[model samples]
Target: MYLLGLGLVLLLMKYLEVDPVATWSWWVVLAPFAAAAAWWAWADATGYTKRRAMEKMELKKKQRIDKQRESLGLKPGKRR
Candidate 1:
């Protein structure tokens, strides 16, 4: 995401002919986008993306359960 943002910024700078960026090669301006793609591919291949999604789901589930328990006058469950 950071890389993508950087790519976007560089692209904009290049397009607007911002001083230093305007002087840079197109390949240099586009490098961050390529890097972002590579990072995404690596993360997916390593299950990093799926693991993060599962962890997020588990956290939301726990929060939901805790909210319900609180509404029912039960204490929040202990954390793992």
Candidate 2:
């Protein structure tokens, strides 16, 4: 995946006739790296393991709904 991205970037630079390293104005080259870093940081901070975050979120949502149902005096097992 890393090699693919690097190859695509190099292809794009070559096709665009842009000197990625020489052109100081090439902030585009940094965009993908910056985005990946930010995404990783956010996932790390949120305790979001890729395999478990979705399941955890779903569990929290169900618990919230159950709490709300109890507050409304609805039977817990009664599915709407």
State which candidate has the highest TM-score: 1
lDDT of 2 by residue, 1-80 (tens): 36447646855775687765436344555566666677778878877766587898888998998899899999765865
lDDT to native, each model: 0.97, 0.69
Model 1 C-alpha lDDT per residue in residues 1-80, reported as the tens digit of each score: 99999999999999999999999999999999999999999999999999999999999999999999899898899655
Candidate 1 TM-score versus the reference = 0.91
TM-scores, all candidates, are 0.91, 0.38
The number of clashing residue pairs in each candidate reads 0, 0
Model 2 segments more than 4 A misplaced:
1-24, 50-80
Cα displacement (Å) at residue 32, model 1: 0.1
The deviation in Å at residue 67 for candidate 2 is: 36
